[model samples]
Target: MNIKKTSVLLTIILISINAFCQQEVSLSSKLKSDKIKAVNRSISLFGDKEDAVEMNAEDESGIGIIEDVEFEKGLIEIELLGENNPGKSFIGIAFNIQNDETYEAIYFRPFNFVAKEQIRKEHMVQYIYHPEFTWRKLRKEKTGEFENEIKMPPNPDDWFKAIIHVEETTVKVFVNDLSEPVLIVDRLTKPLSKKIGIWTGFGSSGRFRNLILKE
Candidate 1:
C-alpha cells in the first residue's frame, strides 16, 4: 500500500480505539448528599421512585452537579419528568459548567410540548449559555436558531427520555426514540470546564433518573 493509504488506515484504527475506550458512567445510582451537589436548589431521592432524584429551584434556576464526574463531550441520556405548569416546567441537562452563574444548558418547556398555538409549540426546547446568550437574548437576537419544536413530543406531565449528543462546537437533543434531533444548535461557548449537571428553571421542579454519561 502507498504511504497515504497506510496513514488513513492508521487514523481509522485510532478513532475506533478511542471510541471503544470511552467509559459509560451511571450517575443515578444514588442521590445522597455525598453524591450530588445542589446549587441554589434542593434535591432528594424521589420517594415514589427508585434511582431518581427530584429537584426544586430556590430562585431563578437550580442545578444538581454530579459529584466527582467531569464530562466534556460524547452522549448523555437521562429520563426527565416535568409538569404542564404553563410558564414553569423547564428541566434538562447542563454541561461545561464554569460556575454557578456561567454554564451551557439545554432544557425543555414541557407545557409547550403540545401547545395549541404554533408559536408556543416552537418554543418547546431551548439551548442557552449563561451570563450571556440567554434564552431571552437568543430569542430576540438569533430568533429560531437556538430553539425548536419537538416532533412526537412525550407526555408533558410524565417521564420522557432525553438523549443529548455533544461535540466540540455543536449539540443535538433527541426526545424519546426520535431518529432525528429535535433541537440542534452550534455551541455558544468554548467548553473549558468538565462539570456536568441536571437543571431546572424558575419556579420549576423536575425528576431525573437513569442518568447515563458516555465519554
Candidate 2:
C-alpha cells in the first residue's frame, strides 16, 4: 500500500475504536431477576428491540435497579426524558440504594421547573432519603434545604443530561452544565457507598439512556 493510504487507514481504525469504547452499555442487559420488580404494572424496555428501560407503573412507582454495580464515590451520568404536563412527571436517580424501599434519590420535577406558579418553580429539583427524609418531611423540617430550583431548566418533554458527583459525605448534581452545579448537599442522608438505580414516582413515566458510572 502507498504511504498516504496506510496513514489514512490507521487514523480511521483509531477513530472507530474510540467510538466503540465510548458507546454506553444498555442497562437492559444488566438487569437481574430480583433487581427490577414491578410494583403495580410491568415496566417496559424499548430501544432497537429494547435497549432502554422505561418506568410505566400507574398506581405506584416503578424502578430498575442495576445488579452487581456498587457505586461509591465517583460520577454518574445519564440522559433522561419525562412527561411535560405540569405536576405529572418525576424522574431521577437513586444512589446508596440499600434495598427496594430504602435509598437516597435526586430526581427532577420537569413539569415544575418552568411552571406559571412560583411554588411550582421552587420544586423543580428534589432530594430524598427514603423511609425518613422524604421531600415532604425535609421541606417541612429543613425548608428549602433538601430541594432547590433548577437555575437553568431544560424542556420537560425533551431529553436532558444529568451528571451526579458523589464524594464521601457530599453529593452534587449538575444538569447540562459542567462548570456550575445545580444542587449541592453538604451531607447525604444515606451512607456513602451503596448500589445505584433509576427512580420514578407515582403517576410518572420516564425514559433513560446512556447510563455511565465511573468509580
Candidate 3:
C-alpha cells in the first residue's frame, strides 16, 4: 500500500482502539467502573484491586475473580481454572455491606454457626451507598463490633456458591449446593444504598471468568 493509504489505515486503527476503550461498563461485565457512579470521583482500591476486579488464569489455576454491580436476580456462573484441585475445599464470591463511606453491617458468613443467629441490622439507601469502583470499611468501632462487622457471609473460611435474592424487604443468600440459604437479611426498604461488590475470601481464592445476571 502507498504511504498515504498506510497512514490512513493506522489512523483508523487508532480511532477504533480508542472507541473500544471508552465503552461504558455494564453491571454484569468483568470491567470495573472507572469512576464512582454517584459522586463521579475516582476511587482507588488496594493496588489496582478494586472491590470488583477482573483476573484471569493462563490455563485454569488457583485464581478467582471479583465483580461489582446491581442485580436483583441473575445466574452468576463461576468457572474454576484449577480442575485438578477438585472438591475445591472452598471458593466463591463476597459482598461487603456499606453505608456511604462506612460499612455498618457486619461480615458474618450467612451459614457459619460461629456467629450468633441474630437479626440483620437495617441500612439506609437514601444517603448511604455502596462503592462502585472502591470499597471502604469502618474503623471507629470497638473490638467486638469490628469482629461482628467483618463476619464473612456464611462459610467465610470454606468456599461456597452464593445466590443473591433481593426482595422487597430482604436479601436472601443461598450457598453451596443448598436449595435454601442459611441467612436471610431483611434488606433496607429504602432504595439500594450502593452497588454490590464481589469478594473471595483470603487463602481460598479463585477467578470469575463469567458472570451472567438474568432476571
Q: For candidate 2, give the lDDT.
A: 0.77
Per-candidate count of clashing residue pairs (backbone under 3 Å): 0, 0, 27
Off by over 4 Å in 3: 1-29, 32-159, 200-210
Per-residue alpha-carbon lDDT of model 2 for 143-196, expressed as tens digits? 888778877799888888999887878889899865788888765564745677
Q: Which ten residues in a row are the worst by lDDT in model 2?
A: 32-41
Name the better of 1 and 2 by TM-score: 1
- lDDT of model 2 at residue 52? 74
Candidate 2, superposed: residue stretches over 4 Å from native: 1-25, 31-41, 190-193
Cα error of candidate 2 at position 191, Å: 2.1
Superposed on all Cα atoms, the candidates' RMSDs to the truth, in angstroms, are: 3.8, 5.9, 15.8
Model 1, span 31-101: residue lDDT tens:
65467788989888785546788898565899988878779998888899999889879999999999998
Displacement of residue 215 (Cα, Å) in model 2 is 1.5
Identify the candidate with maximal lDDT: 1
User: Per-model C-alpha lDDT, please?
Assistant: 0.88, 0.77, 0.33
Q: Residue 108 of candidate 3: its Cα lDDT?
A: 26
Local error of candidate 1 at residue 40 (angstroms): 0.8
What's the true lDDT of residue 205 in model 1?
A: 88
